[model samples]
Target: MSFPSFLSHRLSLVQEQQLELAVLAEHVKRGSGHMRRLALECLAQRQAELAADLAQVAQLAAPRAALRKEVAA
Candidate 1:
């Protein structure tokens, strides 16, 4: 199956954000003072973005999934 270019781009962005969140989590664990605080804030923002992207991906894929089910029936 092929995805629209925009969907592919969004998926890649989501993957990148997930990786960044992992790194930020590590920074939060080992960092201290202002740096740790900054990392925590960034983590929160990235988490929100990831949630939004996941929702968009789900919305885009829903129709394709339904079509597949209809074809199978």
Candidate 2:
């Protein structure tokens, strides 16, 4: 996909993850022992996924950014 489209897709994924985390946070607050544990686990997993997504974006962006700098120079 083109960079714009690729960024859009990633943005959506980030937004969805954010929403999921919000819901999970509520569950953690109100849930009992087992339920809270499950919510916390899901939250941790989601956070890791988000971190990976961000890292991938940065990795992809670095090359394009360097190309832009070369063009400008």
Candidate 3:
């Protein structure tokens, strides 16, 4: 599933997550031109611990997102 969709599945508050997802979506929408793409890539390739970690970054940047991007950075 898509990243945002994945988040939506896990999070209860769809509206709030949507807002944050919208913004992050914009960050990712730039066709790999945006610097934040690095963050997205990190999310994509990472497994287990590192993957969860990057996911947390995205969650934190937005409003009440889920999985609370782990802080062990």
Q: Name the candidate, 1 or 3, with the larger TM-score value.
A: 1
Q: Report the C-alpha lDDT of model 2 over 32-71, residue by residue, as the tens digit.
A: 9999999999999998998899888888888989999999
Residue 33, candidate 1: alpha-carbon lDDT: 100
Q: List model 3 lDDT by residue over 1-73, tens digit each.
A: 8766666555544444555555655666664655777646643443344445456656654753333554432
lDDT score of model 2? 0.90
Q: On lDDT, who's better, 1 or 2?
A: 1
> Candidate 1 — worst ten consecutive residues by lDDT sum?
1-10
Rank candidates by lDDT, best first.
1, 2, 3
lDDT of 3: 0.54
| 47: Cα error in model 2, Å | 0.8
Residue 35 deviation, candidate 3, in Å? 1.5
Per-candidate total of colliding backbone pairs: 0, 0, 1
> When superposed on Cα atoms, how far off is each prediction in RMSD?
2.2, 1.3, 14.1
Question: Local error of candidate 2 at 5, Å?
Answer: 0.9
In the range 1-73, model 1's lDDT, one tens digit per residue, is 4587878888889999999999999999999999999999999998998999899999998998899999999
TM-score of each: 0.86, 0.85, 0.29
Which sections of candidate 2 miss by over 4 Å?
A: none
